[model samples]
Every structure is written in C-alpha cells, then in structure tokens.
Target: MTETVVANPFEQAQAGRPTGPLVQGFEVIIGFETHAQLSTESKIFSRASTAFGAEPNTQACAVDLALPGTLPVMNKGAVERAIKLGLALGSHIAPRSVFARKNYFYPDLPKGYQISQFEIPVVQGGTVSFFVGDELKSVRLVRAHLEEDAGKSLHENFIGQSGIDLNRAGTPLLEIVTEPDMRSTAEAVAYAKELHKIVTWIGICDGNMQEGSFRCDANVSVRRPGEPLGTRREIKNLNSFRFMQQAIDYEIRWQIGEIEDGRKIQQATVLFDPDTGETRAMRTKEDAADYRYFPDPDLPPLAIAQEWIDRVKAGMPELPRAMAERYVRDHGLSEYDAAQLTQSVALARYFDEAVSKGATPKLASNWITGEIARRLNAQEIGIEAAPVKASQLGQLIARISDGTIPNSAARVVFDALWSGEGSEVDAIIAAKDLKPMNDTGALEKIIDGVLATNQKNIDEYRAGKDKAFNALVGQVMKASQGKANPAQVNALLKAKLG
Candidate 1:
C-alpha cells in the first residue's frame, strides 16, 4: 500500500503564494536546506577520527577511503545524535529508515556517490517556530536525513591545479530540509538562526559555520502576488548569516528584475560572493531523478527503539522555545525580549542565573539584551566569554532596583566590573563613588544651592517656561555629581518649586 502525502496549507501557500503586506507587490518564497554536521568523534561508517583541520587525508582510515573489501559499519553515536536532534525539533524519528546511494560524479566524492537517506528519512514532519521581529513565524520541516559529506576541492594552492582534501570526506551530516514557509529574507534568517540554536543547544552540532559545521542553503524565488510559485534558485553553502541574508535579498531582486524585464527565471544552484555581495549561478539544479538513488546493500535499515528515544529525551536540556514561554508566563517578559534572551543556550542560562541571583527579570532582560549584547557584538564574541559574571550583573541590577545606584551609575559600575577595576559589585560602586544620594538633608542643600545659583531659570520658570524647569533639574543633578536619585530629585523639585 502506498502512503498518501497530505500537503499542508502553508505548503500550498508556497505553490500559489499570496503576497502579504510585508511584501506588497511580489510573493517572496524561501526555503532552507541546512546541513548540520553531527558532533561525533569518528566519521560515519568508519573508525576514522572526525576532528576538523587535520592534514590532508590524515584522519581518513581505510573505511573512509573506501578501500576494496571494506564494509560499512554504522556509528551508534551518530544515530544517537540524530535522535537527540529529532526529539529537540519535535520531529518523528522513523522506526525504520533506509540508506541509499546518491550517485553523483565529483572530484571531492571518493566513492563517486553519497550514502544518504532518500525515500524514508530518520526524522520527518516538524515545525520550527521563531519570532520574525515581534510576530511569531513558523517554518515547516520536510525531513532531516542522515548523509555522508563530500570532501573539499581546494583551488587556492597547487599552482593552478586543484587538490582534494579527504579529511572532511565521510563526515556524518544531518541534512535538514524545510518547506517554503518563509515569505521574506528576514523570516528565512530567523528560521535559520532558530534552527542553529536548537542543534547547538541540544549538543548535536557545534553550530560553527566557519568550519562548515552548520551551513545553510537558501531556495529563493519571487512571483506576482497570488500567482504560481516562481522558479527558485538555490544559494548554496551560505556559511554566515550576514551572507545568507545578502545572498537571498540579492537573488530575490535579481529574479524580480529578470521577470519584470520579460526574462524567465531558471532553476539553478548559485554561489554567493561575499566580497562582491552578489550571487552567480554555478550549475543547473539537479532533480531527485538525476541522482538515481538506490538502497545501499552493505548497510541494513536503521531501526530506532522507543527506549532509545525516551533516554535521549530525558538527557536533553530544556528547549529554547519552551524556556521562552516560561519567561513570558512566569517572569512577565514580552515575547520579543524573551525570544531575544533565548537566542543561545548560554545567553538564556545567563539570564536565568541572574534572575535566580535576585535580579529583576525584566531589568535583567533589558541589560543582557541591550548593553551586554552590544558589548559582546562589538567585541566579536559570545556571551559565554563575557567578563562580567551573572551574579555580578544581578547585584548591579539590584543596586538600581533599591535606589542604591541610578541607571547611569549602574553603567559606570558595569564598565568597572568589565574592566576588572573591582572584584565585587558593591566594591566597584564604593570605589567609583556611584551610590545615589538618598540623604534628604544633603539633597535639600544641593537643590537649594541649584535654585540660588539659577535665579535666571527661576524667573523663567515663574514666567511659565518648561525649559526653565528642566534647566533647574539638570542643575540639581549636576550639583550632585550624577549621584542623586532621579525620582527623589523630581519629587523634591516639584515640592520646592510649588
């Protein structure tokens, strides 16, 4: 009996895409095929070490090299990693999945064919929901299949002749294919980022695009609103998110312009030139029939047990989406801020630790998303490498909450902590003299001095000029050397002025 494939409504939308207000004139349909290299110690079907950056062919054993008389052996660890990913993504792990020979001729492929899942994949039918701005968006998953990666074809060296590095050959990869649920470049990127976070958070992939651990291929096309889907060109191997967005945006514009000029869009695979900020067609895209897939006789059908799935699920950490929802329900964070904080496992963990250390949830979210993120981006680093500890940040925020220090003084204290000026938050505040002035008598004296000195402002204020009132406030803050509590200053100023 043949299984009937029911198409989802969103998938139908991809067929005859209706342009929303976001893309008013044209329907921009985008899909992603991400290849996330599994975090395994050895290459699939081989005992060869999968360590990256090895000397050419140093890590490839006889099995990886496909020596004559060698038989393939499945790696249990690779399958376990795949199971973990499936559980994290809410995908169905196939009880029995077959591996097939994907026949292709390329210099980088030692076997002249890739052993991959075709008819039935290991994982099937899932949804990856993420926030595209504040609006929640979801991309449907077609399947995630296990596959062996091809090696690199090097052109930089060898003096005009190409060389092959088999080090990456036979590396285990889980190729995750998504439906064309994305309507714009931003949605596509958000989906990619959310997927990346999931894979890395679950310890399945390292999520390193530079080393080709996690790479995205975007299928982009444009058509008139409510028209049939346009011919899509796949942008291959977008390693960076910035490059991914640039490539998709450029491809969409190019396709639209071509259509407007009466040129038919062709289905092809393209490469994004980071330096040029453009995409150029590489080769005509191949259909599934072109690969001529056949079952690999050496390996048996992969069988997964319910016990294994349960074990993997039990071992997994809390997923990002669930944690974000918890933040919304329990901590009273907005969906946008919750999503921002959960961008990475480390960031989310940092936020939770700060809150556990007595930092207000909303305030902690603001500092992490705003100031800490700014510094981390400027330094070109991850939150895990931040100099300030979560507890320290919590203490600083607590100071702000209790009128111990104003927001301005908190910033100064944070910079001091980041610069190693002091070990403790309170010590930093003391050393920098950043404590807010809470003494009523001292504040009264300061305000009196400000009012006495700014007689011109006083006259102007009596004349009903709002600027004069602001000027007096500024003078009071200046007189107190930015240590006065802004709320206290405002209250005292209104009382004295009246």
Candidate 2:
C-alpha cells in the first residue's frame, strides 16, 4: 500500500529490462482498469450519432462539445448497459449514485472536463474469476461507474502533436476497476479477456479492441513477500491483450532496474507502443485531489428501485460459465466439447436447438463446434448468418446417424449445403448413386467382381500380405465409385477371403 513516489526522474521510454530481476525470481504484481464502451446508438447525454465509420465531426453535437447553455440529457440505454455489466460481474447495484465532473483539460476533451462517477460509483464489491491453465484465479472489483468518454485524439503530425476528433466524444463508458490482486502479467491478461467476454456476451459492449470499444490499463509494482508495496505506474489505453501483457512485464522490470540501480521509482502515467513493445512516461499519476471531482448540478442522482434490479436479472440469459456447466451435466458432453459449444451465445443456442430437434447430443455438439463453426469461419460470417439452418443440419445429422449416409459422404453433403449449388443430401446420393453397400449380398457381388479382375491381389492376400488386402479394398471402392461403405466392404471381404 505504499503510494508515494521516491525521488527519480528516469525517462520511462528507455526500454529498460533487468535480466537479473527475473533470474532472481522477483515477482510482478498487477492490477487492471478495464473500460467498456456502452453499445448505445446515441451519445450518453446527447442525441448525436454514435455510429462507427461516420465522417469526423459529423456526429459532434454542441452538447458533446460542452457549448454554453446546452444541457445534457442522459441516455437510458447507457444506464441499462452499465447495470447489465454490473450484474454480470456480481456487483451490488447502488440504490442511488451521482454523476460527477472529472476536471481535466485536453484538446480531445471539448468540455475541458469529463462527466464521470468518482467516489460514489454506481456499482461495487464484485469478483471476477479467470483460469490460468487449470487453476481459477479471482480478482476483486473496487467499483464500476458510468462515465462519458472523451473525444479521440488523432495522431496525424508524424510529430508528437495529435489533432482532435470529436466524433467519439460523449460516448458512454463503464469503467470497471480491480483491486491489486494479480501477481503476474498472465493473471492480468486472463482477467481482462474474461471481462471482455462477459460484456460482449451480454450485448452490453461491442468489445472491439481495434476500434477502442474496449480499453485496458494495468498498474504494475513489485516488492519482497513481507515488504511494503512498491511504487506503481499506469500503462494507459492498452487496446489489445498482447500489449496488456507486454506492458506489465516491461514496466515491472523497468521499475526494478531503476530501484536496484539506486534510483527510486516515480508514480506516473505511461504509454505502451505495440510495435516496439515498450512504455513511455506520459505524466505524474493523478489522485482524486488532482481530478477535483464534484457532483454535476445539471443531472440528478440516479435512484434504482428493487423492481428494476429484479427486471434486469430476469431478462439476463444464461451466462457462458453456467451454460457450459449445464451442457456438461445435462447432455453428458465432455468438458472440452461443452466449452467449445458455449464459447459464443449464438453458437450455443444453435447447438441446443439442433439437439432438441432429435440430433444426438454428442453428435450435435460435435457438428456445431466443428463443421458448422468451420463453415462460419470460412465464410467470415457468424452463426446468425450461417447458410445451413439448424433444422437442416439436424436433419442431415439424423440421416448420417440412421446409416443413410456415411460420415465421409456427409461432409460432402455439408459442403454442398454450404456451397448452395449442390442438390439436397438424399437427391445427391441418389443422383450420384452414393447409397452405401451395407447389404453383404450387394457388396459381395462387387468384391467378387474386383477379385476376379485382380487374381494377383487375391493370391497376395491368401499369402498373408496386408498390402494386398488394401489394394483389393481400393479396387472394390473404385468400382463402386466410393458408394460402398468401407466398413461393410471390409466385413464382407473378411468373410469371403477366409
């Protein structure tokens, strides 16, 4: 809990990593501040456009720029989004919360301050658990608050100066801060990805890393096991998971190197460069005093009734973890398969619908996670855009299960369905004469014809040569044009050969 910075003025851009510290097994402690943009069509307090890919400044209303006499109007969708996120994280929704102005001045912030929740955040006291390998690590949440996003700064000078793009200003954000519970970079990454999943799954946030829909900042410090906490630095606006991990690692070593070199660490804000994998100092870290947070006079405190909380809870669909567990327990699916099926909400729904329509649980889960997912990814589309409908897929699976088509042929039918130019499975089978030769009488005729044409292979098989048996099966396969089911052919061949 040592928050004071010691006397040091080293540039944070040096890419200083101490090999000795890692070799000595000194650990890095990590914490994260994850910001998720609410998926509302309008700005938090304005009716300006929030759509992406719009022309710059096209969406900036005067309210977004904080012009004189322009009051703010809260977007109900944004508030509901924050509540959904809080409930997903198991946080207690505050019965009442106030909107506060976080005072700061920058070109991107048109108002010279941001309307953010400070000491009294809207939700608090939640825990998020993530898996590091097989072990589950839990991180505690300090608070999740509703806030208006600042405008974007477009770095265009090729110099250090960047221009402002106000199109993004006034977009709503939910800032979820975690306690200092992570002991390494892996834990931080695991926590961040899990949070991203929950927000995106609940349809609260878009979770677009590249577009800055979700951003993460990590605080890193190190100390001996029994020693007091060391000074920490914030690596800001880390947009991707890889950068989040690399930033924590680089920052920890940079601090340790300075401390061991008889230089004290400074508390500051730093930036992570994705290309170079290093952090550069931005400014001294700000405490609450620096922000001068106060309740905004324009907006009243948000009051939540018990009924709203219950309504939100009732509207929630089964979350990913619960659905995964249920799949394993109810359908007798393997843990691996269950996890795969429930990775996405749409995919999980597709799987269950297919199974309910009479596809065997194991087979249905396999197809949805495997072939269906493959087709979806190949076409660069989502399950919602899947060309093959669930009922169609279920019918195809049922056909394969009842021995009307072999597994290999079924894959062809799946591709045909995906390609959209091939006939229906039954029609294709009949037109291509692909009915499997399961009747020993039928397969026996084919096998005998092949053996008569190739007496050389028959002699080799009777001479106990396995390669000859394979050649004979191939000749039978080729004569039947892959119509003879290989399994039935093998059984018929064995009986006749003996």
Candidate 3:
C-alpha cells in the first residue's frame, strides 16, 4: 500500500507566488527548521544543569528521566528567552501557548514522548533578511516554538552497540521554523547565517554549532515551475554552514535526477556523510499525525503577560538590523558595508570605537572590512583579539586622510603594529620613514624625469590610452621610491603633460 505524502504548509501558503530560478529545468523549494539551544542555566522543565560536556546521564534528573510521580515545571528564564527571540524577529508572541507531547519511542527520549509546541507556538510570522551577494533576500518565518531537547544517541566507543546520553535531555530549545521561501543553496545558507546571528546577538543562544548549541534541518524539494510542490527530503542536523550548503545542493540534484528517471521522490530524513560528500536516507520521515500530539497533562498552559514582554524589550540590546541602519544613516556607509561591519557585536563595536576616535567612516570601513578582516580570518581569531587596537587603526586612517602617508605606506605601519614591531602608529611611521614626500618641488622634478624618459607612454596617453597614463604614474612612483603620494603624483603628471 502506498503512503499518502503530506504537502508542505509553506508551499500551500506561497502558492501562485513567482517560482524561483530553475536548476535543470525544475524549481527548488527549500525550508528550514533550526533548533537554537537557549542560554538558560537549567533545562526547560527541570533544574538540571544545562552546561555541555558533562558525563553521560549525570545531568539527567528525575524530571528529565520521566520517573513515576514526577511532575514537569516550566522554567521562567526559558520563556523570557523565547520572548526575546520573538521581539528580535518582529514575530507575534502568543499570549497563551500550549505544550503537546510528541509521542515517539527512541532510547534517548526517556519520556517516550517529547514536549513541543504544535498547534499554537510562541512566535509566529516573522522574516529573516540577508544579502545573497549584494541582492537582498528575505525568507518568511513560519514559527519559533519553545521545546525541550532529547538526549543524544552515541554510536562511538561501543562495539556494535550504541550508547544513550541523557545529559542533554530536557535542555531548553527554541525551534525556529522557516517558510519555503529559499530558492537556491546560497539563499538558504545566507538565511541560516542571518538567523544564527540574530539569536547569538540577542544573547538567547550561544550559536555554537560544534558544541551542538545550535543545529539546522533543511527540507529540500524540486518541481516543474508550474506544477505543485514535490515531496521533500529533510537533511538533518547540519552543524556547519559549509556542510549545510553542500548537503542542500546535493539533495536538489539528487531529487531532480530521481524525477527525471521516472521514479517518484520519497519523503525521508537523510544524513550527510562529509567523508563521502553525499546524503543517504536515515529513515522515512514522519508527519505530524504520526507523532500523535496531545497536550501534556502534567504541565499547565503557558500564559505570558504584556508587561513581561515589555520588560524584556526594555532590557534588549540594540539589534543588528537597527545598528546597521544607524551606521548607514549617520556614517554614510553603504548597506553592504554596514551589513558586513555588523556581522558580530565585537566587530561592530570596534568599528564604532574607531569612528568615534575621529577616523573617517569610509576609510575605517574599507580597512576594517578588507585588511583587518583578512588578517582576522587568517589567524582564526575574533576582532577583539586583534593586535592593533581601534585607536591605533583610527590613527592610521588619520595619517592617510591628512596626506601624511599614502595607503601603501600606511599598510607598512599597520604590518609593523600588527606584528609587535612597533606600538604606536606615529612611532612606526617615524621608525620606518614611511611618511610620503610632501615637497611640491621634489614631486614636480620626479614627474619631469618620468615624462622625459617615457615618451612612448606620453604619446600613448595623448592618443587617448588611459593605461599609458597609469603607466607614467607608476614610473613616477617607482622613481620616488614608492614614497610619493598617489594623488600628488597624478596631479603633477597631469599638469606637466598638459
């Protein structure tokens, strides 16, 4: 007997919307379900420590174990964190939300059923906006619900037998679900990254993928542009952003191949093997009905008052989107530059401090996003750990703005400062003799010598060749031992040629 495939609710909600760009003549529809572990110190329904890396089963209390006569109690901190997320995403926080038992039998789930929100979640109808290589894309959010995490099934260190770790059981989690709004792998990855940033920025989750503080499950499907949505296969527990992209791309190709070969796509849960760079089915995916969801009898309904939400809003930090807009509005930065600067709180604060110290906003942005970012990534460190402080960078930019040193010379000072060769920006400039040649007479003489020797380039320049003009400028700079200011060289050369 054939099983009935349940249609994705997001696809139905987005019907008649323009289909995304096609891959192999079929459009891809993708959605996400991300579990962000809240930063609370205890489990959602118990007081067990939520700290990671504890010995297996040591942290599981009687409540987590679902012992007979044990009652589940709600954690107020978990609820506040949920409210923070809803406010950050501009989602609707339901005044009354219900917790239902998702009935399943897994060794890790000691309760035989997991408590999660089904019919009425805490957050609803939000949007996650991000940039996909300069073009802005916004993915609609379905809901973000409060839930308790299940324990882990450890397959390693056991011969032909798996071990269950209940230490992670009952940990507080906010499972954020997104609509089928992503069309390509790039968009999906960008959406995930933006969501991760929001959660981490607001201090609700640690956003640590390696430690399992945050995880993503991708639902990917493909269909003809005008046809109804195809059955989707979910790629489970993608921890790394790179792996997430790889998994989704491979799944899209695999689904298209199956449809072309006259086979129907099956709804299942698949896992990506990084060793082989492929996705293999783990098990058949279950629909909501299969879980037999029902409200839990032990726990009462969660009802949040407006006054409590207001208090959370009052204590919230400046959100990334708002901060980005402020950068663009007050500092005259491009949207892309602002977005890049606001990627993290530390980076954004560094930029702000540099600007506050009188560095030109545009120059500080270019240096921070270019050289500083490159160095940070190469060393695998954050902006807070940079050898050169914000004040030092601000001084460096000031030198460039005042024409005391060219950008090329400023970089030499930057290297000296970054490598601990010099402590002060001006001291490095003085010690390395990196100050640009400021004498107008000396610059004119250098230009004269360049023009007399490079007559071919001069002729080419007069014949409307822009490259030749640049070549003459290069010769003048080289003759000046690379200490000539680029703007001065250009102006002097143009005056002499005319």
Candidate 4:
C-alpha cells in the first residue's frame, strides 16, 4: 500500500526548516557525548601505566589482564579528577554512585565486560554555554561519568592483520553527555571547541585530538517543529573539529534526503570516512540491554568529602569566559577584541602578564590580539614561545602611547624585537633615530619641505579637493622617512598648508 504524503506548502515549508536559529544556515539540533581521557598516571581500576607509547603490553598488569585472584581497585587520582572536572563545570557530585559491569565481548575487552558507570554517575546536572557569532547558545549537561578505556586495536601488517596495543587499555576517561540543544553544524563545532578549551583550561584533559584525549560522538536527526523527532543517526568517534563538521553535514543531508524519498532512517553505530567525507554504518546501534549493565561487586563505592570539592573548586584558575568578560569590563576592551585575546589560555595568561608589567590593557590587547597573534601564526610559534618578551613588548607599547617613539615607527621596533636581534625597544628606537618629532619647530621644517615638493597637490587642496591634503601628508611622511606621527602630520600639514 502506498501512503499519500500531504501536499500542504505551509507544512512542507516547515518540514524542510533547518534546526536552531536561521542565521546559522539551518537549525541543527546536536547533543554531544564527549569522552575526555583523564590525565592520570595509571588506569582507573588497575596499576597498569596509562602513559602513551610504551611497549604494547608493557603497561598491563595482572588486574588489567583479568588474571585470577585479582580484584579491581579504583584509582584515587581518577576519582579526584572527576570531582575536579565536575566542580569546574558546576555539576553536582552524586554522594554515592556505584560502578557497573558493562558486558561486551570484543578483542579489546580482557574480562569480556568493561567496568563503567551506568544508572548512577559521578556527576549530574551541569551546563556548558558556548558562543555562536555573538549569540550565546547553551547546551545543558545531562551527566558526566568516569569509566575505564578499552584497549586499542592496531591493524598493522602481520601478513594478514594488525596487533593490539593495550598500553591505552586501562586509561581513564570522563564521558560528558549533553542535552540535544545544538541546531547547526557550525554550532556543534563551536560547542566542541569551547568544551575543548574548558577541559584543557581546567587542566584535567589535554585536548589532544590526535591522541584521542578528546573525542565527541554527535547524534543528529531531522524533525518538523511540533512534530515527532525523526529516526536519529549516531555518528561516532569524530575526532577533529573539521571531521565533526563533515560528519554532521553529511549525516543531515543523508537524513533529509532519506525522509524525502520515503525511506525510514535506521538507528545504528556509524564511523566517518575521513578520506571520502561520508558516514558508514559500523553496527546496529547497541541499546542498554545489549550492554547488560550491572553493578560491579569487585569495587566498593568511591567517597568524596565537601572539603575536597571546596579545595578543588578553589584551585581552578579563571576560566576563558570569565576572563574575557573581565577584560572587557575592567580594561575597556571590546567584547570581540577580548574574546580573540582570551581564545587561548596561553595568550590570555600572557596578556595578564603584560598587564601586570604595566601595559595599558586596551593597547596590550590590541598588540597581542592583532600584531602578536598574526606574527606567531606566521612564525609557527605559540604565544608561550614568542621571541618578544612580555616586558619588552609592554615597553614598546608604552613608548608609543606615551610619545617616546613615533607610532608609525613602532612597527619597525616590533619587527626587530620579534626577530630576537634587538637589544631593548628603547635602545633600538634610539639607535635607529625613530623618536617622535613632537617639537613644533622640527615638524614645521618637514611641513615646509612637503609644501614646496607637492606644489600641484597644494593647489589641488585649495581647489576643493579634500583628498589632496592626504597626498601632502604622504610627502611629509616621506620627507621624515616614515618616522613622523601620522596624526601630528595630518594636523600640522593642514594648519601650515592653509
């Protein structure tokens, strides 16, 4: 039997309506399940080393191998770390939560059931707010739980198949789940990057995408507002920001096309083909029943006191958003400028360092955001390794702002300082004779010379050619060998020419 689709334009128009705000292209409803590998020396439940790049099984212990007579024990550092992350995210630590044995059989699971959290988690109820082009869109956190990671599989050449690397087998991971609050591919990427920053800023996760320190699985579906949700597709293990965008974009288009063609979307686990930029089904999606989650009897409940939470909370540094807001409110910097400066933790800390060294906040922000960032990118160096010291850079800005050196010539000082060849900003400026000629008599001499050389431009200036004055100003800059203050040149040139 053929089902007749409704032909109402009003309904159809909204049927293809995008997710979220329209300004972001289409509404994309995204809920991210991010797994960040915790920075711990050992696995969550074993004494196995969690360090990367050891001989494949060198880090495995008897507990890791599931040998007889060995009972699982929780790592204290992993628990403390979960609490630290929860507090940083403003989450509630469940007073008591039990670990569950997530039963699954694979080449990687030594005991055929991985120990993880199921019904009760380490943390519940938190929010992660992210910005999308000046519009703040918040994604609420459902829960964050601590779990042990499975061993990694390496498909190497053994004439047929690859070997396993259990070095990462017992590494701890924090799984952070979010409500389906995102509406576009752009928004999803933005949220992921912000979360990456927060995790790295809190010093819990390293945010190393290549090493799988940070990973996100995005659940995407299409739905008509006020209508039931379409069958959602789960795209898993999307590691990079670009891949996340690619996976979601392809998934959304595929779903929309499938619905339009009257085909039902099947829920399943899928992997992204980075080379082809498409999503492919890996397995029929596993439900909780498939995992057969049950409380683990091997380990007792982990405990945390309020004092520990307070101590962890007090130890967190200023976060990115808060630091950006403070820069704007206290330093008179624009919100856009402040965000750019605070986008990286290193840059933000460097900016604060310069401020403490007596640099004007506005000017310091401009130099760091505009000039310093551009230079660093060009040189392929990070802010922490910048050749221009904060003190030296601060002195350069102060000299320019305080009329010690001509503003136009400061660019030269900056380049020289950045090259690591210059002594000090002041010494370089003086040796190069780049001082601002604030003396009226000295400026008058250059102004007189420009008027004489640009006779035709002077005539044009008087003939209602307002822009001709700009040419005369150029002549003054040239006569002064580009060392003159442009603002002073403009004013002095206009007065003398008139």
Clashes of each: 0, 0, 0, 10
Compared with the true structure, all predictions reach lDDT values of 0.87, 0.80, 0.90, 0.80
TM-scores, one per candidate: 0.93, 0.76, 0.96, 0.89
lDDT of 4 at 436: 67
Error of 3 at 429 (Å): 0.6
Error of 4 at 334 (Å): 2.9
Best by lDDT: 3
- Number of colliding residue pairs in model 4: 10
For candidate 3, write residues 1-498 as lDDT tens digits.
221222335447566555678999999999999999999999999999999898899999999999998889999999999999999999888888888999999999999999998888888778888998888788888888899999999999999999999999999999999889899999899999999999999999999999999999999999887777789999999999999999999999999999999999989999999988899999999998899999988878788899999999999999999999998999899999999999999989899888887699999999999999999999999999999999999888988888888878888899998999988888888888888888999988888888888999999999999999999988988888789989878888888888
For model 1, how does the per-residue alpha-carbon lDDT over 346-435 read when each residue is reduced to its tens digit? 899899899988799999999999999999999999999999999999888888898888988888899888988886988888878888
Quality of model 2 by C-alpha lDDT? 0.80
Q: How much does each candidate deviate from the true structure in C-alpha RMSD?
A: 2.6, 6.9, 3.7, 6.6
In candidate 2, clashing pairs total 0
Task: Supply candidate 2's per-residue lDDT for 104.
Answer: 90
Give the alpha carbon lDDT tens digit for every residue of 83-127 in model 2: 887788888788788888999988999888899887667887688
Cα miss at 380, model 3 (Å)? 3.0
The parts of candidate 3 lying over 4 Å away from their true place are 1-13
Give the better candidate number (2 or 4) by TM-score.
4
